[model samples]
Target: MNIIDKTDEELLAIGTPWWEDLIKYSNKGQYGKFIQNFSTDLLRGLNEVEVGNQFAKSDLTRSLDTNYDFLGFIRRGEHVSFLFRVRSTKKPGEWLGRMVLGYERGEVKIFAASIF
Candidate 1:
């Protein structure tokens, strides 16, 4: 099924596991596992050194509070951008987390992910 055609609940179901893996691997500083489901374009723009640097320097990327609140999503073209109200396990404020999902070579993959 096309990702963009899925309902909100379905999209959440599809994205939740990937999102969880992202948080889990990120907290562990496992760069490979963290980008396992990333799209080609995303992978092309990232590298272990860059990710490691971010993980080392950014508190938001170091350890995220797993109890994130889903802040709905926006569909644009072939992608669905999911937003979450996230917090840092080591910090004390809310941040916005975004994950954009779409099909790549017939498989669902993350085109982008960020915390701000």
Candidate 2:
């Protein structure tokens, strides 16, 4: 019931919207919409506003830059992760983020998102 039937490239392709949505929601301050995209395990029933604030920073929201690219991935048995390199043109800064997505309960769910 795993959701990783597609190739590595395909898996990466599926995550593009996730990355975009993160930046978009952060900028818009739509806490509800943002956390809704996360897996139930990620939220753990915590207050969605706090979780959204934890994921986004005020600096990131101030910048109009929203460009990111996939650098590569790491595969360790069932653990598959991809690193995205994000750039802020307004401030001329860069940040790398790592997102892990895998199958749980016959579905592909995002497990974690951390700064790389």
Candidate 3:
């Protein structure tokens, strides 16, 4: 799916893999791979809050039980950002996620992911 000059369906397609890979990568403690989904600015922002540790902890602790929801989308100039609402049946809100799709380096990037 295209991020630049994308349709809504394209926007939808753009974020799914990143979310799935986020789970897979985080569970494996592949922090570099996990952060690769984001832009440098987003990475810097998340690090300031130590979210990677929380995400890794959640994934490593409950790798089998984690789940995510496609909550909705947000619009930005030249970007089609989507949100993923993550939940764990074990601890409903502990690892709640809000993720978005935006462009970085001329490609679609899963730019923001935060627990809520």
Q: Give the alpha-carbon lDDT of every model.
A: 0.89, 0.67, 0.64
**lDDT (Cα, tens digit) per residue for candidate 3, span 40-115:** 7776676534655565566433352346767777676655656665655455354456667766777667667655
Relative to the true structure, candidate 2 reaches a TM of: 0.75
Clashing pairs in 1: none
Residues 87-111, model 2: lDDT tens digits? 6546666778777777767667777
Error of 2 at 87 (Å): 1.9
- State how far residue 90 of model 2 sits from its true place (Å): 4.2
List the pairs of residues colliding in candidate 3: none
What digit string (tens of lDDT, one per residue) describes model 1 on residues 14-108? 99988888888888888888989999999999876878999788777877988999898999999999999988888999989999999999999
Q: Which order, best to worst by TM-score?
A: 1, 2, 3
The TM-score of predicted model 3 comes to 0.68
- lDDT for model 2 comes to 0.67
Winner of 1 and 3 under TM-score: 1
Tell me the lDDT of candidate 1. 0.89
**Candidate 3 error regions (>4 Å):** 1-5, 46-52, 55-66, 93-96
